[model samples]
Target: MPRDRRPVWAELLGTLDEKFVANAVVFEHATPCAGLLLRGEPLRTETGALDRELVLRALAHGLARAPELRRRLRPAPFGLTTPAWVPDDDIDLEAHVRFHVGVVATDGPELPVLLAGRLNPPLDPRRPLWNTVVAELDDGRVAIAWRIQHAVGDGLYGMRLLDALTEADDAGAAGDAGVAGGAGAAGDAAADGPGSRAAAPSTSGASTSGASTSGASTTGTSATGTSATGTSRSTPTVPPLEPGPHRPPRSGAELLRVAWLAWWRRQEGPRGAWHEYWRKPFLRRLRRWGGRLVRPVRNHVLVVRGLTESLVPQRRYAFATHDLPPVARRARELGGSVHDLTVALALVALDQVLPDPAGPRLGVPISRRAARGDRRNHVRMTVVGIPPGTTLAEAVPLVHAAVATAVEAIEPSPSRVAEPGEPSRPAATILTTAGLAHASPAPTIPALGPTKSATNSPTLSPGHSAPGSPAPGQPGSASPTRDAPPHPAAPHPAAPHPAPDAPTRRRGYASFVPWRPRARSLGPALVGSAVLWPVLDPRDDLAVFGSSYADTFSLAVVGSRHVDVDAVQRAFAELVLGTADDVVAAVALPAPPGAGPGVRHDPGDQPGRRPDRQPHHQGGGTP
Candidate 1:
């Protein structure tokens, strides 16, 4: 393996981030993959079966747009250097594209079960690290599930790949289609649900489409990759790959030479060779060492708790979706970003199930790529610690500040140094946001005309805000007056409460693991923590993924067997749709008889109980 014989991107091998290489190595047993699951009108043939040819054609079109899909990893011998991306000359469409014929209802357990089964297996490492399964349901609808290895690309990249595959549309048409039923029927139905359908005041005219956007969230299960009408748009010309086999460095000496060349090339700019090669590393090391000496003891405890919980191998998953505009508006009114609100919601939910004295340490993945098309896994993990007993209102600002600090301190590459007396593991709970897939010109919330001082304003509930807060020069404010009518989407003071079915309507769909009397746990010290790996780190106790599609914000919760993922999902929904008080009361209710441990009782069925609570303990079995 010589440098001259390698591909054009060969020089990047040694300079690759350690996180990227770690992701490749971890693929041996665990599948660190992000996925998209979409339900829509079935694509059929003259004989009334799934149109396999059409599906394959569309996949080929998309693969051409995303060259990373056709690339496979070529590992270094004896771990001498990072893996190199090489072109796969032959791709087996039949092996990668699969079809399952069944009547799997969107709201039923069958869909999730089928998806889990597909995700349980690892992708064929010999070829590309991506696959698709098109399922035909009994109701004449089809569900498309697409997955790609996290090592290749991230959530944003997945959205770009999806955008390339689906039918093409101008920005306006895409927005309109997304608002209608283009994204998915489930998302559309949920978006129109009571108390959650109000349009946010926007300077822009685009309606929120249900179509998955480029900024939509990518979780183990994503709804952002819907192929509207299952039609393939015309394929664009893709540049051909270099015509030769990729050869990675073989010997230790070659690896060093490659590393040195990559480093030297990076220093050729104005930064100068001496400053970059010597001064910068020394300064960074000194700062890290100083920070470690002053790092709090509580941080150490949080890391330990996360490590202890990571030993459990068995995991469960849950999914839920909510309208994004209203939530986004509410978050804005509360003086925080949508991301801040989501982090607060997740922390509150985790606190309900696992109340730690030192608070929960959250691992937030920050992307470092300059463009979405970069196939390299350029990401850094930042850990944020939330203090115990913090309410939703209190946590928002704290989380915002902590996240700001962590983001500013992130290094371009993973650091080898560890703080004294701390286990180098990821936070116990990991929270990730893929961002809005298709962003509108106007902000999610309409601009407030004018308003009084912050101290003089009325205090709103945790998840609620006044329909239209007065802006700086508005008539209702203490400042200059201006006449302006209220936005049409604003809720009236006398508006009727949402019907009892509101809870069910707020969520597009949900799936939880049934409680088993004898749930097994992976013994201690079997896996590494995310601090040393990716978000799909083997040691994670719970990982919550958030993404947006059109007007909808989707959440996917992945947790260990001992954790009650169902409870977390329910808590999050209630917190978003109802008040904090309502969540507390609902979570306090007892479970109905015959409902297994960790199963959430339907609030509609149990008249007095809230919809988010779990049953009381009976035996020593895990929840």
Candidate 2:
């Protein structure tokens, strides 16, 4: 099969990346990226310290089998086509890993600063777009950092790649050292096909074969003379390779096809009963959609009074774990799911921070992984009004209802559409549950050292600074003055007056008209990183990412200097605590017998779902 054809979805994502790049350059920030920080026990061996060369060799061997790691981007010439992925024949493994001495925690106080420094530089698209940094900490542990471009893979894929390099048992550890070189022989270079356990589009632009085992080596090595197999190798510097030739881009016709396919995919959906109302002519459909749109949340103003932007960017991370069983129980009692509760918690938290009671429309992502033949960037968001000034108990059901309505209207792909009367899965399920289809567990590499979860600080004090106060040129805490100009890109009111009430729903997404003033897409974007990739954009006023592991919940909040971190932290703490209080109140009443507190339930489980599960699709504007 020809490997030059690019998948429509991949090309669409690459085109979006180009837009994000342009936006970041104009806004003085880097394009959004995803990262992982791993820390583990010390790497030690019976003989002596394992050298960096062995570690490099093992990683190089593993990455060679993972085609995504060896695939550099080939841009389309003259903006005529979308970017394509091609094999990188000349890879320099040594350039990707940075060696550091001392104890570095993955979830440590110093992590944000360190991560920012690494992220400051834009990725060189000419080469494979990723890097792994290794650090040996004073605590006799090792820290590994993985950074990958969003276009290459999502969070689930990143976890799988990490798993391939790890070993869970001593026997597995013994096979790790030599595993790197021999791993490539296990490569399955064919495309990932529909229903394959491992999914990645082949260079031929088809989703066919499963992932190659070349990237899944058992042995890992570190500088402490320890390998995953307990062997040690002499230290030697790995030489860099000469750069490969640049490949020619696709034709303009292909670029046009890519854009057209993306648009068509955005409108795919089932022809179901709920959509019957949308089949009317243009005017009739418009009138019916207009009425339903008002039922959703209202869009609020972006600029708040008494707030200013800071020239520097800042981040504050906070971690806490709530009892999942109790929270899950409360959601069920309210006729909602755990996912609904998470969104409510976010909205309530925003209300506490924003000057206005009602918050801005949120960009809520809905994963489209069920789509056949689509192995890349299959996510669409539904914009909805935030329910501020409402209690968790009152808001839970409302947000749940609103989300269900929005998903039904916005999802165009048939794979994601629910059967008639079948309830849509809560977007929150991505964060609240474990055992998602994408995650795989593997053993630790001995050379890299045994891995462990980093200790999380119980609570982040308001206004408290990270261990390294200000990294190099970063600014210390300070309030911005009114004179500080607002972000040039974000929507600003002509004056600082109250924003008008939510406008009537327009027919053709009129608000996005290039001629009219538009709302800034640089405001806060919430991400639940428990399962999906966490998108961190430097230009946003605030980016909040949350993850729940074992019995702990962690939050990493990144903001520009213009925002108030102390105030936001206080509000966030209150919101989380408030939810816990609600859970405690509900613990007194046991759930109806036979209903497990955490059993997975969906619309199909409801008493009166239409017996025929399939729903019909309709043609109309989405809310």
Candidate 3:
């Protein structure tokens, strides 16, 4: 195989790195698939009906720009070598694209409910590992949910793909008009009679549209883009598929040669190949043993002690939005970045809602891509520890310094090959932040009109302070403002220790696990120091994903079934907006089953209550 024979873009798409391979392995063993969910205005025809044609056209344009979507993983024969990226000749647009009509009661839980349903199921490995669903809301809005396997790309890559699917600017107005007109023409043909319309495109054995088989009620037409009464309509012509370079299966001899070359490249250095090969293995063994020896004590002191774990296998999602300007200004006033503020606020809010003796350790992911266009998952994880009862102001500087040091200390290509049933480092929660506003242009859909804030939650505007909230530098502004009484600082009762005869839980090995058990007994016999031991717990209590696009900063919290995601979301919004009674009332809802009573603060509660003990800022370690 000649590397230079392929186009640079195609080569990038086909090149599988250790991190990418690990992601694939993790997906197979533990984690479900991950992707993006975006909401916007629904594209409508002149007659005000959902315009399916325009949606397909926009998707076609996106597919052309992101050729990675048309490729699938081809595993090596009998696990002889790593999987190779190969082109899928049968690119069925109808099978991959679907529509849902008027199923949402409101923008709040319905969309996430739909998203959760879509996310739970794994994408078919045989086909291109991506799917898009267009959802029409009762409020006349549209939510586009696109899910891709983790092996395809990371969060940043997903954002880039989203950019490709959308128009650059108002320039798309004419294109939207053209597509809508074509759809109207098709509708007119359908009106004449079913026989007058163009023939429906041929489909493979797979269902043409997911929504068609979902048994959900749809308005005006069926999910297949035909009338509910079964009249056929001419489907819009989508752009030709532009898949990556096709690589045929290699022979056994070829696989061996490729594997040999890969090993040789690994041995290339100042030292001779023989010395480097032996030395590397020896060092890895030494480190592994050293880690195992010290892991229990380290985890006990830094992770397990003073922490509360409320995680279960089930996940629930809650979203909140903040106006960017005020949050940015506040962060700058506190001598930190928006990311620092985000971490700080999360700590404050989590402590209030799920009060523990100690603040949770946060696992932050840092991207290590060499360039903007790098398609591989070049990323590393760094952990940061916040002291118990630290106020927002105190937490910000600590978080800032910790994140900076962690980023500086990250080694290149630190991702190790994932092994089955391997335990990951214990972190109570994970925080992921992406500045989409600073990335590529925001997705623009003329038919959806200007992109607006997806949430109806109240936001603080520029030069505006939260209600009854002082300026950042003023007194009473150091801690997050609260409208509900703070929950008692006492930690929730620790989970009951596993029964003596109960099987020890095996922590899942995956690139991502939403929630997991918190503590495991390593036994005093193994450490020869303490009776109680601490080991890596693969599950986390919570994961907060924050992204900024244009003027809005959105935070989505995914938590375990026992956790009250909605309460966390509300607390986050309150902290960000600094508003009081009305905001809380508007956002508050009954807590989900298994959740504790919602915590509300009194208006008289002080905002600058300092911690009684000295704050401890734990340095970053492997996540």
Best by TM-score: 3
TM-scores of all models? 0.52, 0.50, 0.55
Candidate 2: which stretches are off by over 4 Å?
1-14, 21-39, 45-58, 105-108, 115-122, 137-140, 153-338, 369-372, 412-500, 503-533, 536-539, 548-553, 562-623
- Ranked by lDDT, the better of candidates 2 and 3 is 3
Residue 196 of model 1, lDDT score = 20
Please give the lDDT score at residue 254 for candidate 3: 52
Error of 3 at 294 (Å): 33
Model 3: which ten-residue window has the lowest total lDDT? 524-533
For residue 214, model 2's alpha carbon misses the true position, in angstroms, by: 43
Quantify all predictions' global Cα lDDT against the true fold: 0.38, 0.33, 0.38
Q: Compared with the true structure, what per-residue lDDT tens digits does model 2 show for residues 1-623?
A: 65644332223334333332222121223222222222221133334242455556555545643656766665544433445665565666655665543344322333333332232222455677776555442222233445565555433234334333432222223335444333233332122122222111112111000000111112234456343322233335654432233322345455556555554565645454336425556675464344334321221111122111122233332222232334344445554444444545555555455434434333334433333222333333444344335555555555554555544454343555465854343322111111211111100010111111111111111122223221111111111110011112212111111246643111100000000000000001001111111343333444343333221223333443434333433443444344322211211112233757542122122333210110111011000
lDDT of 2 at 138: 26
